[model samples]
Target: MVDRLGPRYASTLGWLFATMVSMLFVYRPPLSLLMLFLWKVVGLLPRAVPPVVIARKYRDARASVLSAFNAALTLISLAGPTIIGIVASTDPALPSILRATTLLIPIVII
Candidate 1:
């Protein structure tokens, strides 16, 4: 299945699998730290890739709009964790919700 998708998508799927499996072992401190690092690296990927990809794939006015959109998304992505952390900390009931949402982050990104 992976071979059919080519390298980028295949590696993405592999990373997702590794991250999900890592979460199962997260009760162990060292394993949890490793998983956290993996998740962090994966989380940064979209910010690193999208603007350049868009710029390369388009030109002139369309490229400008795509670049702007990509920039906004990157900024939002960077801010998302901080915002979620603040909300989780300030509201007692929100931590569980945030945790549930964040579970997908590790799997999808890492």
Candidate 2:
């Protein structure tokens, strides 16, 4: 399936998948927490796809920069849930905690 799509399509698909997984995190934290393992799977796709596409289409320096950006993004994405969990657990009001968590989503997405 991936071979048929080409690297560009594969990379775009990775972005789409990541975006969808991220949306799940925002819309339903409980469900997102339950499907956290799937996030790991989606996360791996971008790590592999972007570097391959960048190296093919651009110079080494450009590819390296893109790879670095993706790596930093992945790190931030990994940290976000843990931070949200800590906040949600520490807070007394569930709604307020959820609202706080939702606010972080846009920052992460940006």
Candidate 3:
């Protein structure tokens, strides 16, 4: 699949599948077989594709490019949370928005 579609595309699809599964959480479904089904399905997605695709994509990349990519990722990761934290810390309603995003982290860890 990676060879045919390319690592970038395959990785995108992997993350997309994970995101689609995660969207189910917004419904606040009751604890039942369905909730278990969603959790188990979401867990499978990143394990299935992301690590291999990401590792393969970067393994052969030049050191300079990888360094730049890492720096960019670090900047974005830090900046987003810092900005959101600042907003949520000051605003009452913003915390819910930040809390909503908490659902995304588990799948991302996978």
At residue 61, candidate 1 shows an lDDT of 42
Give the lowest summed-lDDT range of ten residues in model 2: 29-38
State each model's C-alpha RMSD to the native.
19.8, 20.1, 21.7
Rank all candidate structures by their TM-score, best first, as comma-separated numbers.
2, 3, 1
Candidate 1: regions farther than 4 A off: 1-58, 90-110
Candidate 3's displacement at residue 43, Å, is 36
Clashes of each: 0, 0, 0
Give the poorly placed runs of model 3, Cα more than 4 Å off: 28-110
List, residue by residue over 10-33, the lDDT tens digit for candidate 2. 644554455467545544433334
lDDT of 1 by residue, 35-102 (tens): 44544544454555687664554344444554565565555454444443333334333345444554
Give Cα distance to truth, residue 49, candidate 1, Å.
34
Tens-digit per-residue lDDT, 1-110, candidate 3: 87998755665455445445544443332344644454444445455577777555444443444456556555444444344333333433333544345434543433
The C-alpha lDDT values of all candidates are: 0.47, 0.50, 0.47
Return the TM-score for each candidate structure. 0.26, 0.31, 0.28
Least well predicted 10-residue stretch by lDDT in candidate 1: 23-32
